[model samples]
Target: MSKKRYILSVALIILTLNPIFSQNSPKTEILLVGFDHLGQMDNGTPSSDIFSPKKQKEIIKLTEKLRTFSPDQIMVEKEPSEQKQVDSLYKAYRENTLKLSEIEYGSSETYQIGFRLAKMLNLETVYGIDHYESTSQSLLSSGKNIDIFKNGLLELMNTARPMKKKVQQDSLSIYDYIKTINQPKFIDLSHNLIFNLPAYVINGKFSENGTNTVDIGKIDEKYIGAEYITLFYNRNLKIYSNILNAQLDHNSKRIFLIMGQLHIGVLKDLLEANPNYKIITTSEYLN
Candidate 1:
């Protein structure tokens, strides 16, 4: 082909690939802010009383810190099906018609952090992206000759007990404890607790010449431990899906997700792997 023809052909090819290239690039900046549950529910973990004047003030401070990110959308750990209820409560709160003490909008993080942040940013609605699967620790103890696995879990709990007690005894504010938990070391530890512990019990106990007896009972126990871990993973996967399904403006959307600290490690990994998102660390905002 002539020089002009060749140049025009190349230009056309570049033009054709431009949209695909852009599509592959990151468009959204997601700040994954993992927070402890605010309501102090009976979830077998230490719960914070966020209703105190001191904790409330700290929450305000936390909101002020998060406001610098100027997130366009705030996502919470509530299920997607609950969006209508969340939107309704948010609207009422915005209008000064709903009291925080009201049963409809309790001290839950969805209301405390997510709703408060969205209001601070002047956003109309907060998004709910949680998916729940009934999980039971008893499953790990169900099969025979599973005492090793049970003991391993007990040991893990004992490991975490001191930190929990120290946080309570040191009089660390809810904000301070949350900040500590979001740190890299703590996040890594949380990840291991969820992913590594199960694998250790399953692989170490069930492998040939392992600690546990190589019998049908041990195999079943190993499978039970694995199933328990799988439920944890599946719940996080669905939560990530709900995040993606949220209706967000592509032009200038920055999403801030407020979720339980336990969900953060897996969700962060999933978000980091997606090309459509640029994961923003909590340290960047909190610091």
Candidate 2:
């Protein structure tokens, strides 16, 4: 019990507590909610009336569940180029000085979902991370390929687009509808509608499903199939880039992003690969 024993005991105590003090912080938390654009869905069918009393109740319920997440930043599918415009609109909305109908974006998910959630969380800024890219393609021949493409579109018309043809008349609430789209099956359906469809047909036969990676084929035949798929990936890739840029090294532990359901499949893979993020889903909250 001399000086040497006392020094050894002190060293052991310091070493044992170092790990507790210096442990790495957990990775950033991200929740990607693939919310259908409510306003746009009112096109063909006669539903998705967000302003309706019933739908408003559902929206309130949905946001109540999302409120638990209390995200520091809310990212929307709108383009980042409109940051100043969005900031102004959001500020007005937060201040209760703006009526959504007064603005063109009121019907957009950027307002219905993004603005609503940001307002609920009492957040100051909503980030727009969407990207646009030019694309060109079409069906030119009649064959099994055309049949497949038509069938895919039909399936989407029936299944993928939410709140269609009297959704209000039906029983499903907006909360439940949003929950359904966040599921993996719904995300896969969206991906298949685009990539798995027979987008490029040369002759009576069609290219294999998901053959977006084009090879150097005959000079006369352009790889329309690959180009079509590439366009989807390209736009989503740019959106991913925008998300990273939007993050701005802020200390946001949880970030909520609202995008088209189609984006979930691709962005999930991209964000999962990054070591700095830990991806979460609505399944935990919505269910």
Candidate 3:
């Protein structure tokens, strides 16, 4: 009834609604689904290709379930060199969404699981990993110090060359990816392959498994055992930290990360630390 009373009441109402408004605002949710390798089967055991009939069907089913979360954005680990290729593949798929099932795996070497998922969900996708295509060229071109990478690659090539049976002309530096990752076993494997048979090491750029080869200096026969053991356990935690930092900054309501099982150990640790996120496994979706 009184002017002062009315003003005070209005102020209270505004304060109450502010929190609600803020809560409803758009935010980012990042889902990372890491597979062992683009495998031949749903078990993720080196499927022929992500778009294989079986793989597509499984992905369709998975998408149907992931759609329940209504993710705002999807991100996949794609190399920059592959972006144009991915775009072309996506263009072809978008042009022929109907025949996607019948298309062969090689139809578009660029398209993978994330591309199809984004297409099915009609969501935006991003290539998160900072990979360079001509890392050697880039290193040579860099104005800043390049020895870290240049020398690293040279040393890696020299040490690993002996091991490689036949080297491919087109190879990229995996040190960038490997350095970002902190897995002991992966490092050990890289070390072993680089030192023992460098030529066969290819590009040293396997997804999370460290199956690919990038040159690293000789592995100390004695230290190899300890170094790998340490890396195996440590890699997951480091990756978890990177993922957390990337995801928490967004306004995503439900985020899924597809990563290797080895990374699961790290995710477990993260879920324990952050109470806000509700971690659900693929099996949980089955139920």
Best lDDT goes to which candidate?
A: 2
Q: Each model's TM-score, in the order given?
A: 0.77, 0.77, 0.44
Task: Indicate the TM-score of model 2.
Answer: 0.77
State the weakest 10-residue window (summed lDDT) of model 1.
209-218
What Cα-based lDDT does every candidate model obtain?
A: 0.71, 0.72, 0.42
Instruction: Please give, for residues 113-213, the per-residue lDDT of candidate 2 as tens digits.
Output: 78888988888879889885533223323443566666766787788544544455546777888898788888887777677664553344333433333
Residue-wise lDDT of candidate 3 within 83-184, one digit each (tens)?
A: 566566566666565344554443221244455656776755433432321111121212223233345456645644432211111121121221222234
Error of 2 at 115 (Å): 1.5
The clash tally of candidate 1 reads 0
lDDT of 1 by residue, 1-287 (tens): 99999999998878657742345544689888776566753234333445656668878888888899998888887887988988999999888898677855377778888778888878988888888665544545444435655666576566555655554443666567677789887777667666656654442223333222112332445455565567678778888888887834334468888988878899989988876778888888787
| Candidate 2 residue-wise lDDT at 153 | 68
From the highest TM-score down, the ranking of the candidates is: 1, 2, 3
